[model samples]
Target chain A: MDEINLQRQSSTNDELVLIEEFFAQLTKPKNLDSIRDKAREFCQRNSHLKIALVTSGGTTIPIELNTVRFVDNFSAGTRGSASTEYLLKTEQYAVIFLFRHKSLEPFWRHFSSDELFSHLDVNPETNQVTVCPSFQPKLKEVISEQKKSENRLLKITFTTLSEYLFTLRELTMVLNELGSKAMLYLAAAVSDFYIPPENLAIHKIQSSEPLRLHFELVPKVLRPLVKFWVPDAFVISFKLETDENILLLKARNALKRYGHKLVIANELNTRKHKVTLVTEIDSESIQINSQNDEIEIEQLIVANVVERHNQFIHDQSSR
Target chain B: MDEINLQRQSSTNDELVLIEEFFAQLTKPKNLDSIRDKAREFCQRNSHLKIALVTSGGTTIPIELNTVRFVDNFSAGTRGSASTEYLLKTEQYAVIFLFRHKSLEPFWRHFSSDELFSHLDVNPETNQVTVCPSFQPKLKEVISEQKKSENRLLKITFTTLSEYLFTLRELTMVLNELGSKAMLYLAAAVSDFYIPPENLAIHKIQSSEPLRLHFELVPKVLRPLVKFWVPDAFVISFKLETDENILLLKARNALKRYGHKLVIANELNTRKHKVTLVTEIDSESIQINSQNDEIEIEQLIVANVVERHNQFIHDQSSR
Candidate 1:
């Protein structure tokens, strides 16, 4: 099929059939009920506080049932982890960090993905390895903050796209009672295409021949998430584009279709340096500067998001 | 085309044209000449030492030029890292580890992939973080061993399949003079198919539509390595299978076709527990037992391979 025809087919199929098929075919994540129970308890315990579910990293979609190979998005979980740190710094919200397995985490993102051996001073004479003195202050800060928020933060990991979708749905259902008090900072780079369960190869794909893979567009889950699952929650999504020309338009389209509160739009090259916050009413650009290098752009993003959430809560109470 | 036709086409095209096309189209890895120079220097300095080039982890194949998504093989570098330890235990060879980026390394593979925070003892009041005492001995051993081998082990990392092929060819040529003294342990899980340079999408593959990807079979590089690059090197390849029934047959076929010294055949479920050493004449099944629970299976695998290499060296001298 032509590219235009294929796009039309996918967008049309996305409306209802795709989402319904996805849920119907998807096997629930293992131990999901117990996780839901725990989330329920967490919500009940922290009724007075706002809870934010921040998703990070890239999800995988296995082409084989006994997956020796899979497709993956390019993400390091920098944005989500950074935002979580900023949110915690405010001390205003409890976080449920649903992240891709082995991706970066809050406070830990400062370190490079090398062996911890490099950060330690190994004294052969004494047979002791200790954290280097230069890194001590940051380590102390991270540990102290972590210890203080031990009960407030929950981390859940998923490697596959299917597991991520299932876990997300279950978490939202458990936190339904929190209503507008909850926020979804959707920063994960989720896979857009996946082989259907029935189509997945039973064995590792053999290397003896040419390969042709057919993938159906993953039915967009945002519609149900916004309309049905915790409908009153202040939801924020992300739009990552390489082209500057289509960035704002795509972000606006997503906000209109999903009926979410905000869309954080970023070009691939400038994502770390600048981002535009496209809300229903207006767009605001946030950028890093020479003075604010120590304080990341995420600090600004979180501040604006928190302010909007506060306004949203106020409007609900007034009504 | 039919499946049979596709297989035939791929196998026929793999002879010479594919390899030429791949090299011509591939962007040379940055600093490859410097790396080759270093390898030559290493060989000259350690001329008396038996050198083994051990490949580890998984290689990626980008679908687009600006890759937002890519296909990847499933490997954590466990086998390669574990084998490296065994090879070092013999105290006979210098190692050049060509590995996938962020995958495991020797000695450090003992630690889990989670944040190192869990392994630390954090004193919130004192504002200090220290490595937990119980894990001290292993950490010391790893660090000391690493320090001792600082000059012996050379690590080169690759993320993409094209880079891997380029690096491998260069390394093999540099080590060509070592002849039967050199061993090539091929353990890395490589992607079987890739979108050729001419066909790759310029931008990220948009998810707005059902996506059908066409991949050409990656040309087999083993033939050139065996016959042309380092013809007299003691070569061993791995055959990882999910099915037990066909494992031995596939391993035997690879040995026959490539004229390699050995093929280490393994079933995915039992790879860590058992492996079959398929040689030119016979297949030997090696299994782990309770008596040797403290020792890894790789120690045994490496021992057998080392014995064979010794015999080969002896045979070469006699001739």
Candidate 2:
């Protein structure tokens, strides 16, 4: 009876995840072609396929222009995108990249776009275009999203903090239904505070001078994962530093705050790329580096990320 | 009076926020070249400039790939380039662009060299190159770090998230030393987590198996306010998103995170370009829509950002 109930639950959950084409199409589209390619390359060749769900990009507080409200930052999506790409290079487990906006497109295009410079604009005055004067943004850069339908290396795009929150929440819900098939990579640049607009019209209509906006902290996404969501699942969360210039201080605090599997941290003005991976629950932290003259930073990041995913897969298989 | 401090602060702050070049090759440079251009156009006259601060290119994370360990990203320093042009557009702020790689000239030429693409291999039978159209690694997209003295833009090319953090830190330090005013816009994609391999031995590195990389988050350099480093300043940040999802969540989240006085949030992929001007604590958030044409999201962002700065000035004058 227990097994039967679990099976039914899984069926319903997959339907919900797959059925919501609106969420995928309207805001972010899943890169089916890439996913199919990934599926073919990684899963077909290697039977044991595990995945680390990685997310990146910035968040925002929604408010209108006429009414003085809200705050936000432009995260180039470097960490999240870099980490996801790095994890994929492992070839151990296929990666599920869930991201939002301009940050992820470049990576996908970099990997898939046939030519370079296809996206860059040309100057009318100098008549100069393309970075290399040779490479172009690739005519095939905008290959229809259709091509990626069968791909296993799928990248789902998203924008706005709430969209990401909903995404995380929904994915977590699916994970419970799937009975823990994948690990969670909590590297998304989620905003600490969110402003719940009191009244939409009143706020927008009352435009005299500078308006005031109030906010409160959003609920913790990862803490619940270990506590309520899924105790057995592997989890990793990111901690950004602003106050205590100390790197470990921030990472330690993050581990305590989220209770994830690992926490990564770096310091300011490091000439070369650097990251500190802090393992939660008593395991020692590992330091990863990408050299100034070595492999690109993003690939290295993906590599480590995948290694973690593989560890989980091996551990689960052992069990 | 309070009003006097605001305007005086605006002018005084402008000096430090603008770029400063001490290469000694150029006699003098101006500040905020875009604003200067506007001033000149408004007066329809010529204005002699003194100093130009050039911030060039985007950050590169030099990670080692396949033992050779060289890789890069898609930042062309176009935004910074436009910023320089805008500075020169005004002739008010001598333009000095601290740019990243691939965004400048000599560096661009370096990429065009045959030596760079010599690695491209072709099959004699098929006449098809293994990595055709472009064989060079993506990192070559990074702009060169070399600079010329006479250039109006002061370009500072960098790669890797660490380098970006370092460059900004050093630049701000220099600004403090010279007491240069500035209109600093927080643009460019900075990598967050890096492989923290500061102490890894080169020979000990294993090539075959997956390398377990632990990453720790890096600290933000902008933490130390320019007021402390280079007092009296103009600073602006960029935020991008799509409107198909939830805009309010994004808008409010951004305001809370960076604490920027003004945020320029736009919805792409829509019939009309919609931009919301956000502030930390403002009288109101203004939403601007222009279905008619592309009115310059870049400039519009700059203007809204400037409005806050202008408000500071206006309040100063009133006082």
Candidate 3:
């Protein structure tokens, strides 16, 4: 309960109070290097499928060599990662995730009740068992921790768009050889434009010079990709924006352009938002609205997405 | 280059054709199990760090819940595992990536471009190579991966909202001990509504009933999370949708609701989209339109985010 948790958290500052001091300490030598070997080891061990297919972290453009690849994306990996979870629900599908900085925290155990169990709490009014018996070391805790799926799927992270693209192109071939069941979901903040070839290394490296990275056109993945990779498998794409009123219109065009089974269209202002599912089956957009806490919108979508996929599988089986 | 790559692209349906026939043999093992092991190993090796900040693939919610959390989000990392590319960019962060089935193709080779280069070809019809020659032989490839000053930080990836919540809660304590110097970006598709505890999982797994999962609020990372982990380091959140023509109106509400820096807002339905930024300074909203692609949008937001963080760091140094 927030009531019990509040006792410990009451003193923690909610506002950005130490932005300067905290950030400065990070630059210190002691801060530059930290132990991530455990996390990396985790990625390497549980990955049932070794292949990785990333959409990077931004929107991608179709049909242009004079295009740019996103160095970064607004996509911190909410939807794509969630779907990745569903995809990982079974070993039949192996996943590779490359995410942005802000997006990596969830994977590290920051907000689970398990984490709360470890927090230290001391009753100031009276030394009391403010913590419940369940709080003490118990089998339930150990089982929860062990039955803990020990999520072992290779999850990689990325910040720039080029890295994602270059990685994907090759991944296509690998998955192609692996099976006819390969899939691709164009999620993330991929860019339609990339910094010119000449400037890629320098500009990306320098991190200076007015910072006017051009919005160049990126190659279209729909058709050529279909012709090239696992043509028989499924491929999904995305179209995002800040506007909520015109999702249908954008989805129609995106479906036509990408030919992906599901085109997810949504407004991009709050992390809590809604989505319009654009699929070819009926061309009717299914709007799903959500909030930040992720109780309502997420469950509906999760159950539906799983059911939808299950239906697709079921229909295939019957056929 | 695309034109040349296009020309060099062999019109060979050989691979696809081979896969099409093999499709019927679902039992035909493609040595994927070994690859899966390799992938898992990758995670295990990288799984070391006090605070691992990772994001899945969706948006976050915008409200509060039980005075604790709220509902929200849409991105499911059908493509998150490919986040390996981010690690390559800079060794500054530690990462563990678990991906979705649909996203494996995009980030397959990011961890090792040599594998990608092996798949390249020079179309007989055109002298140009379909894959970049500098990245040839896959064997000769050198990882030019950058570790943006933060790569050494440990990281992890989750597929479902539940998994994300579980892992997030676990990571919170580690970060708390280490200090609130990191950042969290709730950018995964965390389902807003969930199936109430017991029945929800059953309904979904057993395929019973119309799959009615009620809204049992997930924990809130955007608000209460800051109270524990990375409170001082910068945090960035996102909003995605197909509507919201008046960028300022949408962005203003986002800032007021979710306390994050640089909210990137855009129109999800338009081919030519625009992103409005919502930050501490431009709280009202500053739309950055783009007929090009998301890179333009990414650059705009990235620049501002970098600047803000840099400023925070600089201020700390001065102090």
lDDT per residue, candidate 2, A110-224, as tens digits? 4322133222323346432323323322223222221232244556666555567655655555454333456677666676554444423322222123323344555555665
lDDT of 2 by residue, B112-211 (tens): 3223333333335753333343533342333212222223344445544555554555455444433223456665645333343442233212222333
Two-chain DockQ for each candidate model: 0.55, 0.04, 0.01
Q: After superposition, how far is residue B62 of candidate 3 from its true place, in Å?
A: 20
RMSD, one per candidate, in order = 6.4, 15.0, 27.7
lDDT of each: 0.85, 0.47, 0.42
- Name the runs in model 1 displaced over 4 angstroms: A1-18, A113-115, A289-293, B1-18, B113-115, B122-128, B289-293
**In terms of lDDT, which candidate is strongest?**
1
lDDT of 1: 0.85
Interface RMSD per candidate (angstroms) = 2.1, 18.0, 24.2
Give the 10-residue window scoring lowest on summed lDDT in candidate 2 chain A: A141-150
User: Per model, how many backbone clashes are there?
Assistant: 0, 161, 214
- The model with the greater TM-score, 2 or 3, is 2
Model 1 chain B poorest 10 in a row by lDDT: B112-121
Could you tell me which residue pairs clash in candidate 1? Answer: none
